[model samples]
Target: MTRVLRLAVSLALLLLAWEGLVLMTGVPHFILPAPHRIAAAFAARFDLLAAHAVITATEILLGLVLGVSAGGLLALTLTASRRVRGWLLPLVIASQAIPVFAIAPLLVLWLGYGLASKVAMAALIIFFPVTVALFEGLRRTDTGWIDLARTMTAGGNAAGWRVMLYLRLPAALPAFGAGLRVAAAVTPIGAVIGEWVGSSGGLGYLMLHANARMQVDLMFAALLVLAVMALALYLAVDRLLNRVLPWAADTTIPATSR
Candidate 1:
């Protein structure tokens, strides 16, 4: 498709510029390898990188599920009762204020240097956006729908459930999608930060190891793999959103979405 071609062209141009800059500056490969050298390094270490990729991806998946579930349930409680939101929502907001890096060591201290810490970091980064988006979605139900529910013997709890489940949820799908995109982008960063602080396996650990040993080629390759992994996760989330919310799949977003 034309869109795919354009993206390919854009990437090619970016790579070309990178290659040209390195050549013109006479930069050492150890300091900053050209694209070709980075590619060669990646190919040579493909198996090792693949293994680390699997670990990082697993952490992201498990964390995403945990964060979505907890955050969604919390948001539902807030929407169901004003008292709950008044008392409970501040804690949720406060949690995000704690720097993820600051908590990295604490997570390691509590969860050890395994997948647990990385998953915790990812969940922390992801939970707030999902909660906020779902909350807004529940609040955005149409007044006409509420009136019609009253007329149809679906008042009170029935009305709320019908709107929340059928209309508000579908309308909120796009925000949830947007929030997912933000969460996915941050997930890898969280995982890597965890690895930097304590983990034994993962691209982040591999990068630090390579750097400490002066294996610049291997480090560059790992860095490239990390970038690719983040992009891949983002794309996967986008595809899922489009698949589940086909109404949002169209090229032009409606004004009501604002």
Candidate 2:
């Protein structure tokens, strides 16, 4: 089956199971509304959902752009300069030691309860993976390639920069693509956490209000929307990476009976 068809079938099965369990258990709607109830809530408040979704989407996109750019630059810097790496690498590693949730409040306080805070949160979350992946890729460039480049530029003063630009950068694309996929997957968590901590808009804010009002169905609808958004973003990024980095083909081995 096609991917879309498989996804549809899976969703249908899950909804059926969920509805069946609720019906059999006689659970209260507030506790766990039936799928139909959630659907009703979704349709009823689509306008509200759409408005908040746009804000969240904007934050995620902006964050992704900023994160990828900064991460790529940092990775290049770390690879190119040992002195700088010694100073910056530890700080980068230390930053990840703190939980993102604990940092959300501080980000809100610093950047304020606006788009800035959300964007920063998402970028901060995305930074480490991208930096590490690209740095390792750069560092692990084939020694044979480096030797060839050095021989070619035996008398040139700019040999290092030339090799970095022509050889190392190309080799690192696959690793950077891998890190980008991860960054895209986790992009939503940062924005939503920022919203949950302090925000006037976005799906997280909507869900928070819905829960406070005991609108369980509406809350579920918002959560569903967030899931769909995250899935769509990740798929889009994956497809883009596959197209852009055509040489980085998947090499996963299929399972077979012995």
Candidate 3:
């Protein structure tokens, strides 16, 4: 409750400051609409915003699922086979060298400006972080634990698979959780960028049309919605990670100590 109240207060203050700035500057509404104007626009276009927001949210969620699954699978494969890792890791690293914005147009061109393009963009943006985090985690699993497992298993043929399934995967989950949080934070960027490049529906599409029409208030409203959506997704991911990975709790110093 306290946290919620603090957030509300902070937002209210920000809006007030924004409104005051616009009033003082006497800027045209097309350039920078006041907060009240933005609120009015949001209220007037609630249905339109909701429709586009649903599309954006769907793309983000689907992309997250696909990225996480593919990344996890690749990490497992790389961990299980040194030859595959040697061949594939360089390619994965190289892929990130090309900026995502540069690829957005190509994705839209290939995927045809649909949900597929947006989802692919989002998945590609997050894939590297998840793969690297999980791969490192798997690789860095405590050697002592592996030694213990080896001794217990008596070096049988099934020992390797058994150790991996029971020991390595569980130990690596905390790192994966870290990667997932990062992916959640960035997932929206990819979807929005793809939509910006080309899309029939989404908050990014709405923002583009609103800007072209000089509906600055509406554009701000769409931006606000996107910000809220991204924040909510990140918070949800953080909470879920905390709940799922209790053993990996954050080790921040206390405020008093700091």
User: Using lDDT as the measure, which candidate wins?
Assistant: 3
- Tens-digit lDDT track for model 1 on 4-101? 99999999999999999999999888888889988888898899999998898888888888888877888889988999999998988887788878
lDDT of each: 0.83, 0.91, 0.92
Greater TM-score among 2 and 3 belongs to: 2
Model 1 scores worst on lDDT over the 10 consecutive residues at 249-258
Displacement of the residue 152 alpha carbon in candidate 3, Å = 1.6
Candidate 1: list runs displaced more than 4 Å.
154-159, 249-258
Ranking by TM-score: 2, 3, 1
Q: For residues 98-187, could you state the per-residue lDDT of candidate 2 as single tens digits?
A: 998898999999999889999999998998999999999899886777887878888867567778898999878888888999999998
- At residue 3, what lDDT does model 1 achieve? 100
lDDT-wise, the better of 1 and 2 is: 2
Better of 1 and 3 by TM-score: 3
